[model samples]
Target: MESQAAFNYQQQVEEIRLAMGCDFVALALVQSEERHFQIRWEFASGNLSQRFRRIVLHSGKGVAGIVFKTGKPIFVPDAHQYYKKEDMYNYPILIAEELESFAAIPLFKYNRVKGILLAGCRKQKCMSIEKFELLQSLVTPTFGPYYSEEVTGI
Candidate 1:
């Protein structure tokens, strides 16, 4: 049986993909203690392939990993410009999904980076700054079993 939280993550990704008209939307979650907090691609929608399942991300490595380690969002208007063709291979999701533009946000829980959310497109710069901001806002403040501890307006 699928866990409710896992189910919610899938549903949320699908909803975000449709609402944003994105080519791909995925969630990377950190595994619990027995798993050593390893980050893995857990849920996704609009993906071109299942290659993400074969990938295991480390902190500060791929898009999700970087966001996970830094606790800051990463917005790449043009993946090609932002990352060299060779460097592109470093991000499994980008290569697997053939993403040309993308944005990754860190999901916080108890003030620590706990998960990652990514939205992207196959076309260059398709994920615009405005759209990126909107994406950030859409997932803001809360997610299942996780709540952003970001400091907001006074």
Candidate 2:
């Protein structure tokens, strides 16, 4: 896609966050050839800190990285209960974004994970499976070059 058109990434993420009433929404994208596939949060909404923007994740380090490596979706409700605080920092996006419950879905292009779209809530257990499913449905089959694997029959 043209870089100009792609600049709408932040706008689209914010729209999704508002529509879902999520506390935070962010998009993580793999850097082009210059960065050798390193991933970073490219856009965010309702962010608590800028720490996430400085983080450059490898292919399997954190949630977005893991999703990119495995080409799968990840959901964590009640992050404090699901992950210890010490370990939680590994996911800088979660920490800087102040996400308590979150889901990360891979955005695919040509059957490869190109980026991740994340939605989160600051309140524990605020993101239900139904909402997660809905979010998945909403982005599937569309969303720039990213398509949900489940809907793509992959």
lDDT of 1 at 114: 81
Reference-based lDDT, each prediction:
0.82, 0.83
Model 2, residue 130: distance off in Å is 1.3
| Candidate number of the best lDDT | 2
Inter-residue clash pairs, candidate 2: none
Candidate 1, superposed: residue stretches over 4 Å from native: 1-7, 148-154
In the range 55-128, model 2's lDDT, one tens digit per residue, is 89989989888999999898888899888888987888877777889998998777778899889998899888
lDDT of candidate 1 at residue 105, scale 0 to 100: 85
TM-score for each model: 0.87, 0.88
**TM value for model 2:** 0.88
lDDT of 1 by residue, 42-144 (tens): 8999988788888898878898879887888999989888888887778888989989999888887667788888999999989998888777777853366
